[model samples]
Target: MDPTHSTLLHRLLDATTWRAFDVDAEGRILAGHDASGSVQLVELRPDGARVPLTALPGAVSGRYVPGSRRVVVSHDAGGNERAQLSLLDPDAVTAPLGEDELTPLVRDPDHIHGLVEVLPTGEVVYTTNRRNGVDFDLVVHRLADGTETVLYDGGGMVGGATVSHEGTRALMTRPGRPALSSQVLLLVGDTTTELTDAGEHARYGGLEWLPGGETAIVTSDSGRDHLGVAALDVATGHLTWLVTDDAHDVTARLSPDGRRLLVVTDDDGASRLAIHDADGTFLRDVALPAELRAGVADFLTLPRWSPDGTGLAITWTDPATPADVLLVDAERGRAGVVASSREPLADLDLVDPTSHGVPTPDGETVPCFVYAPPEPSGSSVVIVHGGPEGQSVRSFSAVVQALVGDGHTVLVPNVRGSVGYGKRWYSLDDVERRLDSVADLAALHTHLPRLGLDPARSALWGGSYGGYMVLAGLAFQPQLWAAGVDIVGISSLVTFLENTSPYRRAHREREYGSLERDREFLERASPLNRIGDVRAPLFVIHGANDPRVPLSEAEQVAAAVRANGVEVEMVVYDDEGHGLAKRANRLDAYPRAVAFLGRALA
Candidate 1:
């Protein structure tokens, strides 16, 4: 590995990727590009020209207003995730847009106003916890009159709302009592009706209303372990299974014309796309490029359908390639790059991962993607994904590539409690069973030899919940790992639940176990509690203003481990939260961490 972290990691970080979010009527694509150091909204013109929509320190996402010429942009402060909604008129902005060009629609730094959908009637449906700071209420804001109305105050965190085509009604989601599940609600003329059965705790999302609004298409795990697309009747609340995969989860979206359905299957971690009729009749599959997965910048959601419905603008990428939006011809059944986010990194050899399933001691299989370097580096890094419910898929990761390029093998594991496999797999390590997922780390190390990696020379790396896994791995199974890098991870579950934002406490308690009822278990499961057991060198990275895990989580863990006479390096970014958003900070931070890894592993 290069002695200087800047040389190797600098070039790797320099390679940027653009993601297409929404396409306007004139074929101008609204995308998030990192060419300007931070991810900002850009308008990709038809004639190869580009217009910058926002210049901010944090990343921004926008969607074209259904019936208006303006776009609705969602921006946040420092990565606090307290989203503020604004309207941006492309014509009104200069070549490089300033903050003043955006007209604030919902501005409250203290509260979160997340963008849900923009109705054709020039109204925006969003969810905000401003009502009480504990429960999020669905709100409708009219751009014309600047009138705001509380759509639904469900007494809990209202997950998301999808407005109807005519804009008279909306479908909302409320987090269910069970983890990885949600309750669907239909709101029409001030009346909200429950759609899914309350008894059955199943995950429901990607709700799209049919032409007449009688039947809606949704992706759910209602009666099955795997997520599948189903036709939901609003009146009767009966669901007719449209497409189901025995192994992997699948999501579907209704095409604009309402004649075809675009079904995307999560085959392992990669994606496969297929077209189906409205009735679930199988149509021809859209062949994607080898090794590439079909998705938008937002990995979970399906690609955006063109306004005419004759084509689709989809984002495609693999472990080796950056994301680029491709246009798929619905009739011709072919794909071509319409808006390219591919950078000038073709000269660099980006490593691709091969899928593998490691068997755990408890007869469960942990899905992982192994990225092996061309040359043997002796040491390996296991990157754990956050969400505990989030799955590590085969996608382009600069960090993974940089580490592999530096000659260290990287293993991304989707242990128990990760989505995309099935509901059963994600529920394996819930609440009292949380440590079972951490045990999967030792299981992964035990099976490392099968993949020609040494367990003794391994390290753990992750952020958020994954960060917790890293700390847990180093503390609980101290002998297995050589080093650990925890980014905004929870050191103590007890503190995490107590210090987390009020709006998120109850919702997160559903997965991590309640602070009131399970305080003892939370303390026992906390890595900070077991810091005395840790022997490996550690590197802690955190944002000072992080509202999720809180900076104290990082501080206490670092202080505890350092007091034990073990080497601990802590890096805190003052202007960030949860994760580093700016490329300048990333260039400094990631390289330093990698440099630390090199020394610790050596």
Candidate 2:
């Protein structure tokens, strides 16, 4: 790696962000911090003291039990994302909780579990796929005797599960088979009722049960292009719209007293918060502090209501700032930073991206964020985001900043199948339509030269699905890119579906199509099939334990390209999965990526 690029990578990796997941009765915040290079649970004290709670190898997320001192943290091994729930003692002043100190609430090696809520009775409610690895079932685990009881087992993916304040009722959301649509189920005692029939092409999520237990609030896109918050009756399946907007409106949380509602709207990729009364009346928009408003805060930690219901604990971030936990007053809308994960950049100039839409050949506009250095390098790198279902929002990205610092323009595009753009746009790249998104990338490359970027010097880069896009671009449009980098991306949709973890296979097949029926289409869409067409130098990175894409995705493509006489480099991380999580591995992998692109683009 070049000395300058190495320094740039160090500066980018040094910045750490903590996400405030939940607050305890004592006002201690449970947050996920990556200060140790791997994400772990931390107790953020009101007095400004930081205490490490869990030292997991991958990402960790948890919440504080309202009435107890114990916290529940969920983490997956490596990056397989089969989350396991564990109990933590916040007062122990422990170095990450050891294997012995941590008590597993739901421990099934072959199954995945997620923490839903911890009741006052010390009973934990979570969703698991133990019954059938493909579907999630809501279960209640009694902490007193360690008894597990299944609450509900609807035959589909359970997105989330939430219990009402009094614990008499619960609400669960299951996305439809296609996933662009969803339905909410209400659980009362032994009976269950469907709350909303969002129909086809509509999606509903962000479930928040009201204190009354009879009514709940949720975000729905039914009969509208944008998402809106609606109050639903648990018994009658009736819904009353509380807030509606042309943009996507999401229900973040309802106050403890159930009087104030924290609502966030997706304005393109930026977030705007609106407050509402319990009776479905809009109060006012919470004024985002200038710092938060300046950059992309699309994924703000779902704003949590304070114990007193007068304020909210939120995680805010942008391109120039790492995430910070802030307490914002509900009445005044004033925000104060409670915990910060900002790191000094050592005088390195960071670029703030400009969001715009690029016109594709089919007359569709693709959203994108561009970060350009001050001096014209005439070279550019297109960074594609994973989740053909995900969007590229404005957020702080060390890789983008580092690449821009190295005098190359960076473009982050939210292609066709991305969310936040309504259901129709989101399904545009599904299954056989996948390569349409690749065409969007080619269109983006064509527009770069107009922005003073030299097409011949430009490279394509991405991870996971984005990584798939990189390979697709190089193969489908061989002359367009000078080089390509793939990180845990799929080279062959057919092989990926066959090799991916069984639990996630169905869900992925929904997006990429199943091998049973669409085998030919999948093969034609795969970049591996077109390896002979790729003319650019290619670099591939993968984690040995990745359950989603699997390590073979990288090996197969790298081998095929090498056989075709194309310059190819492969780097595999044994300790990581899905994506690189540990700080040390990232430090090792990313610098090499920068150096590879630097040499190829130069």
Candidate 3:
């Protein structure tokens, strides 16, 4: 399942996902909980593998305790605003690690936010508290005696803890200045040794120690485009990149034989997996596509390959298709769909093929898709998704359905840089031509009227980076529509990155350009600098407590656009972060957006 194209369900369910993955002392599959509280970790067939958690309760986070075979899972109970975390034994039966029993005692009026690791000698839980606009330090607990410890303080982000094969060294991420371009540190017995230096915002976050603890594998960047594996000398602190010049990302697993590496990446905008010699050279290419590129929260997850590195499996689905798994030959990259999650969904009835494409300024062609309930006399809305990295899928979308239900036609134009396209297409979305996507967006609107779509009924809406695009479209082409929605989107690239968390400090360098280093470039690409030119009935949505694209971002435009008396409306949700995760926020928001777009563009 190479993702050169896709189905719809991929958009429906992929907001973010988590599955409980557990392995035994010998590194074999023990149990997996897609949801929790089923017969847990019952090792039924193999010595290293435990039984699967057949009945999952739609958990969002989980962890496997060491020494023991128990796994803990977390979920936000429906109708309840709080989160619940519970422990599950191998039989899929669960036991709550109540405050009295669980380490890193859950916060009152709040819940735990750590991955539990049960080691042979102790139970370790990693959680954090914030300070000075940053995730200060992580608090760790040793459950063997219910004793708590602060392993790494606010100066760094500590995670991906791996005990050496000998259980002597614990390697984890140590965030450095200017954000996520962090280093890997090893706490051996008593000494804290640094294995990497803070480089461009790339992180040495994902780490795996060699079986013998002689070396470690970490991830960093090459040419500001992709993440690659780096082999490090645990004893000397020396490191080197494993791949070059191809937008690749990796999670390397040391082979049981101690002489091979299993890696995954979408090096060509097409999924790929490879096995390399212990020395960082390619030995074999593995078959994996969708899973290798699936987004979980803000980053991509690398599926766990078989212990022997002989085979691999992953899951993927899109709007017009059902979820399914892919299994393949690890060395040769030969692959095939192994299973479907459910019966295939009925395909959608697409209309007027002529309405499906947008022409870019450079004359490149892009595809656009529109869906609307039968509305003979109503307005239409054009939507751009965040992550110029994202594309509108053929599947069901909560927002899309809500808009259509309210008599609004929704259009998704995959202006270049959206995945599922080739490398050149995706790269075209880089900094200098940032507005090209918005330009293509306008072409779609112009193309619509020719297809019997009313231009007077059209408007634009998007969130995050897409929201930035929405604002950009209206700023640069004020006559495109009648209204727009900008949700927690960036008003200025320069300031957005300047105050953003370290996690994205490095990304801006490649995505747009550095604020301190490339001030002019950043300014040129941002819409805030040009907000004075925006003309529309703008309703801005923002999370006052947002840590990604901060609330100030929306406020800047709200203040500026309103000062100009452009009919700008701004709404803020303080409890929300980068998005409206709380139910009340969503319920109130959906109706408000419909009303706003309806009244203005109506």
Order by lDDT, highest first: 1, 2, 3
TM-score of each: 0.96, 0.95, 0.63
Which RMSD does model 2 reach against the true structure? 2.0
What is the model-wide C-alpha lDDT for candidate 1? Answer: 0.83
lDDT of 3: 0.57
Candidate 1: C-alpha RMSD after superposition:
1.8
In model 2, the worst 10-residue window by lDDT is 291-300
Residue range 167-282, candidate 2, lDDT tens digits = 66788887766655677888777788876764556777777777767778777777787777888787886778888877564555778777888877776777777678977677
TM-score quality measure for candidate 1: 0.96
lDDT of 3 by residue, 1-602 (tens): 11211223232223322221433443444322221322122232334233444242222344456556565554433212233444555553354333233322344324324453444455554544333323434445555566765555535345566666655567777554432246677776556777666554445546677656777777655234456677777888776776543544455655544567666564322334567786778876654444222221112223444555565444443332233344445567665544432233233332221135666557888767666556634568888877766755544344665565555677777777675444456667676767776678777777766556788778888888888988887787887778889988988888898877564555445666567677887787788888788778898888765666877889888898888789987788766666665445655665566678867865
**Candidate 1 lDDT by residue in tens digits, 69-132:** 7988888888888989888887777865655667888898899888887766778889888878
As a TM-score, model 3 comes out at: 0.63
Which candidate gets the maximum TM-score versus the true structure? 1
